[model samples]
Target: MHRCTLSKEKLAAQPGGEWTHSVSAGFLKTLGCLELLSVVGLILPAVLDIAPVMVPVTAVCWVLLLTGAMITRGRLGQVKLVAGDAAYFAIAVFVAYGRFVIEPFSS
Candidate 1:
């Protein structure tokens, strides 16, 4: 018995086709959104200090997003991207943890 394999041609032709488009678009959008949120969360809180809560919230979200990114990239079968993404993700998590635990919020 032989298992079905996706060919480069098949994968490429329909990439951004039906389900592919939606899933890819959603994931990419989510990634971009998370980065933006992370920045806004870290900076806005430190500068505005409005809620001062935004920092932790954003940091957590960043770590979460990176987790998703790492998973998605892994499933998508991109090794180089996965490695880079995971490394960055680790950094993000560390920063988040640092903000929440170590540095925390200060007046």
Candidate 2:
């Protein structure tokens, strides 16, 4: 979420920003909003003891998101970025599996 927010800021500050020029500004904002919602889905449902199943679902979504990022970075020939995305994907997978089958949150 923080990174998405920063990317939005970068896009706003410089419409033709080098790093962001590859993607549309509107798409960046949408991505940021989606990330914010994913965070909420990650925390609120479980914390409030309402629809706790959403926690693992959100984690799975994160895995998909990070996987897409890894693929994109790989295609861009950004090996370093792909490594970081892979790490994030692994963590998300761990959390998803843990919540879904290991120590699931009680509803």
Candidate 3:
């Protein structure tokens, strides 16, 4: 929400804000909204026991999002940042794998 709602100046004032310069505000806002929805999809359905299958699906979406982030960071020559994104991508992949294979939620 912060990234979607904050003014460009305010966003640029944040930590690691320099990366914001590499992308348009619209892109940032859209990414922020998608990320927010992904977080909800990851947690809410499982916790509420309504549609726990969404957990793995959302994790897959998160993996895709992080892949884009890694590519963007890599293009920007931010190798260190790409490593962080890769770490997150790995975690998302793990979650997806665990939910889809190891202990899947049955509908």
Candidate 4:
């Protein structure tokens, strides 16, 4: 994982790891940690029915994160990567809208 690897060379060895060079390891690790937590926030509360509203909140957070990702990729002229980010952004937006408006879980 790029986040765990301290050596730039080691990170570059992995597929798509070259992107790690654009940012500091600390930033990457922080981002990775946040993403991991966002995933947990998306699933755990909903599954346990403890705070299902967190699912939509997490989805909204993911959308914001992906928006930053898309801007970064676009600035780097990574058109293909931007497209992928757009797809993820769309999915996050859909999830947020669905959970918040269409089928929100009742408390």
Candidate 5:
């Protein structure tokens, strides 16, 4: 939610939105939307028991998003910026695997 709010503020052309400065406003907004939706998917479907399959799928999507962010940060030579994304990627991967195999949500 923190990240999504910041990206949304960037859409308003506000200052201090450096987190998304590397990308265009439209791209940032789209990414924010995806992130927000994934957040919803992470919680709502499982809680509601409706299409609970979405939780792991959303985790996979987050893994992909974090992978892209890490690659982009690498290309920019921003080694320091890569850590967060890498950490997020690890967690997302774990969620994907755990949810799919160990404790998948039931419909």
Candidate 6:
């Protein structure tokens, strides 16, 4: 009987944090997916054989956006998730460099 009440309390306490994390992470994950597609589809094509400045500009914007996300998570005491945004920022920078300069010069 006592165990049942303890289990119930534990279950009740979980949704509050889990749901909040799920919602926030879900939002960021979806946006990250879009950004990924943009990097490959839009930025890469632009940098490879077309207008070049937009790709770097987009990369800068992406890094700034992720920084803002990290700041928000910090304000919410969710610093553990900041690593994901940091990775995204790094990938964006890498994509910018690889597409705009490295690939063009190597080939």
Candidate 6 residue lDDT tens string, 1-107:
22122333343355222323434444545665656665665456465765555666577678777787777666767666677778888987886687577773332
> How well is each residue in 36-78 modelled by candidate 4, as lDDT tens digits?
8998998999889888999999999999999988887777687
Q: Give the lowest summed-lDDT range of ten residues in model 5.
A: 10-19
Candidate 3, lDDT over the whole model: 0.86
Residue 7 error, candidate 4, Å = 5.3
Candidate order (TM-score): 3, 4, 2, 5, 1, 6
Q: Report every candidate's CA lDDT.
A: 0.63, 0.78, 0.86, 0.83, 0.77, 0.59
Q: Rank the candidates by lDDT, best first.
A: 3, 4, 2, 5, 1, 6
Q: What is the TM-score of candidate 1?
A: 0.64
Looking at model 4, residue 39 earns an lDDT score of 85
**Residue range with the least summed lDDT across 10 consecutive positions in model 4:** 1-10
Can you list the residue pairs that collide in candidate 4?
Answer: none
Worst 10 residues of 1 by lDDT: 1-10
TM-score of every candidate: 0.64, 0.78, 0.85, 0.84, 0.78, 0.49
Q: Candidate 3, clashing residue pairs?
A: none
> What is the alpha-carbon lDDT for the whole of candidate 5?
0.77
CA-only RMSD, every prediction? 9.3, 3.6, 1.9, 2.2, 3.6, 10.5
Model 5, span 1-107: residue lDDT tens:
44545554544454333446556766776787788898998889888888989999999999988888788778767676688778888889998999999997764
Off by over 4 Å in 2: 1-19
Candidate 1, superposed: residue stretches over 4 Å from native: 1-31
lDDT agreement of model 2 with the native: 0.78
Candidate 5: regions farther than 4 A off: 1-22
- How many residue pairs clash per model? 0, 0, 0, 0, 0, 0
